[model samples]
Target: MTVTRDSITDFVRTLEDDISRVAICGTSYSDIGGVARVIEQQAIELRNGGYDIDIFTLEGTRKPPEDVSLHALGHFETSPYKEVDKLLTLASPSALNFVRSANRFDLIITHRFPFSTLGHMAKVIHNVPYVYWSHPSGSSDELFEGLAHAWARVQHHLETQNYAVRKADYLCAVSEESGEYIEAKTGREAVVVPNTITESRFGDVADEKKINEQFGLTPHDTIVLHVGRISPRKNIHRLIEAFQAATEGEAECKLLLVGEESMPEYSDRVRELADDDVVLTGFVDDKTLAGIYNRSNVYATCSLSEGWGLPLSEASYFDLEIVAFESIPAVNSLDGAYPVVNEDYDEFREKLCEKVNRD
Candidate 1:
């Protein structure tokens, strides 16, 4: 269905203290990456605004706020058929219970794929309306790049997500690129609600010197940072290769890879391609990460795809020089981000070198 500005405004108005509950469901609820962070923050804001919330999700390392109801279903372990696993999880005993009791909530909001299918099920079974919230209208190889089973897996996701999009009452796109894709693919209008950074959390004090000391760096050291899960689609190996070429004649350019390893083998490959100048801080706290962003000369990513590049947004907020592929919408939206054509590795390297060596 077409989602207009008035409809969105009406929806917000309906989210008053009088509403009993709102269900926010997603594929995962961990600090694992962007989707989790966005859902967590949305839930927090909704609850704070006097709306009661229930969080339904697949198993994840992080848990929701205690005040809200949490219905975590499914396994924590990775599987070869993730799309099939999601379908099974949604059909699980706990999920069936949710289906039966879904009327308790005023609205169901779904994040990412597959879970949107679950929310669609709620719409079909309980006559509830579900809001589809995610990007990349259909799965593309961009997400599963470097993985052996990428072709088949992405095809499965594409089919499932297409169905989810069709069933959703309304769509919420996190960026203009995604909104356009949704409109073109599904022939449905989507409300664009961009991802945001909490200024209070990201803006306070940061000790650049202390951060550099912690990383064993010096005044001459130029840090190029990439903050995201160590995944195949991130094309981090390309970033590593570019960093090498960019700093070949530099004084001392360092590349810091932060965030958890989503794929161990991929992470290992990144490490194997690295030298002394590459540092991997698996994952750090918010304060530490903010400090590192402050200390870094440039924030870079060679990701093949993104719904919305939250790391790039955060980097832009931190006032770091941004460098990323033009295909990434969030980076392109920023004021000073240096965006190069997606597949132009040579130009990417040159831009990185210029930003790093800039006074």
Candidate 2:
């Protein structure tokens, strides 16, 4: 049966009644990237609502509340070959061990690619029904040039991902585009449950003095914030370039990047372009992140694509204007979101400057 939001709700309630425990398994989960953040938030929401969820991750610390449980198995490097890590993580024995220790769970919810393979394996081994949370398709590689060698590797991974999708008992996509991609690739319908922002979790900016001091900013400085992984896919280099052109030699403007680097090479390249005014915070907790959002003048991203623009939505909640690519379907649905022509840094720079001026 085709899954809709209402149906998924009903299905989840049914699972809640029938099963005593549910496991949320993923490749890597922390408060950093959107996928992990979404999964983390879902687990919290579910638990707060009286559902039992135990999060299992391949790598990352378990910092959830006392009532909640988190199990992490240290990360492993696949081999001498790169990009194969995604596949190796899928085959992680930790996932299988978690499932076997429980002997059985009422349901399994797996997020993103490769990790969803764990859900597929659970079904084969124990006949447990599993839900797969779909993310950007591996075929996204086709959009970027000079990835021919990586394309073959990506295609192999995509095929494995598609196989898992076909085997999943239920599917969820974070955005309509992702849902459509899953359907196109696996011929299975998926429910759309976009990432959420908890209003109560935010408050007045945590003392601006402390924040500014932390980032070496002055009261007159205009913070242009970008939060997420630093990688080629994030198009952070473009954002930095746009910021430089927009602000030029203005000492009163600063750019803050608050997340870990997924691609070290890309991180180095972005740093090469950044001036002393750019502050890369690496990673910050949700409380600090909320303060950063509240303290910033505007939010900006030039991601080539997104399953859902969770950060943009979070920024909008704080009444910050958004600057992003027009092709980003996720941000289009958010209020205060300004989309420019795709990859048009000149226009992106103009928009950034406009938001700064208006603020």
Candidate 3:
């Protein structure tokens, strides 16, 4: 459906009364990654608001919260071309049949494309209103650079992302920067619904013993934490180098690089750069992550880009000092965060060291 200003206004006016059942469409729901966390939180919130919520995804590696239903379409073999597997899976007869036969949803919230394209199809077929939840925007060149089939991935990103942006009944973005990016790319305005951290989750006393046992750290160790995927875009290599320089002679300082390796080649590079002081704890659960955050002295990220930096917000809730480059959209938006000049590794190292040494 072609959405107009008046139509969107009318929909918003009657949203509370007209909408009750919601379908959140995404690629996967895993323990790590910001997008999955956002989808999980959205389902939880919708369910708590008395709206029936169902999540449809290609993979559901993590169980969802109470009262929210999950439907995982079986996985497909990896295609040699960019996004081909996902596109084929979403467009498959079984997927289409499930969408058609499933109980009608009042609204569909879509994230990531090709998956969002599925939501678009539902909108066209069932006349259900669908909203595209914008995560990353801007040129895909930087993200896909150095990967195999880079041009194909970039082209696929352009086509699918733009299609979802233009066709959605409404659009929501995780950050103002991303919102601006969408408008620039598609000339469509998006409502900024910034990702949030639940304070209650970080409120309890951290299990120091668990932290000690798991990472072999004592209370005396000054832990610096980076919680995100081990990808090239995360700038983990730079972070490791900066961290090593910052804590050169400080044996008490430890850098914990958390989260699973999304890119194998990049992860191998990161591992090669890591020394005895740097520990890569791949994919920790939420409870353990909370404990790690609570026991840490500083939270740091050298990410090249982010939609909203959910981990940074989680760090804030733990009251840990944050150190990131000013160029990151999420760091700029966060209060009490120490942001150094972009790409200034000397300054970055100095600031990180200062934060680490601070009592």
Q: Best-fitting candidate, measured by lDDT?
A: 3
**True lDDT of residue 353, candidate 2:** 86
lDDT of 3 by residue, 1-359 (tens): 22323222243445556887888878888777788888887777667667788888777888887888888886567755435576567667768875685448888888886667777778888888888887774443554445444754654464335675588887877777777777666777777777776554455555998787889887789999999988767889999999999999997989999999877777889989999899899988777888898898899888756777889988888788899987566687777698889788899999998988784
- Clashing residue pairs in candidate 2, if any? none
Taken over the whole model, the C-alpha lDDT of each candidate is 0.76, 0.75, 0.77
Cα misplacement distance, residue 109 of candidate 1 (Å)? 0.8
lDDT per residue (tens digit) for residues 1-359 in model 2: 44456333444775546765778877677666677767777777777666678887776664764477888865557554444566666446775576566445778888765557767777888888888887674345543445434755574456435678787998788767777777777777777777676554565447678888888888998999998888767888888988888887677888999888866667898899999889998887666888899889999998867777788888988888899987776667888898898878888999998887766
Q: lDDT ranking from best to worst? A: 3, 1, 2
Better of 2 and 3 by lDDT: 3
Q: What is the TM-score of each candidate against the true structure?
A: 0.88, 0.87, 0.89
Runs with alpha carbons beyond 4 Å of true place in candidate 2: 1-11, 14-17, 78-83, 89-93, 101-103, 137-156, 159-161, 198-205
| Ordering by TM-score | 3, 1, 2
User: What's the CA RMSD for each of the models?
Assistant: 3.2, 3.2, 4.0
Better of 1 and 3 by TM-score: 3
For model 3, the superposed segments whose C-alpha errors exceed 4 Å read 1-16, 80-83, 139-152, 155-161, 198-206
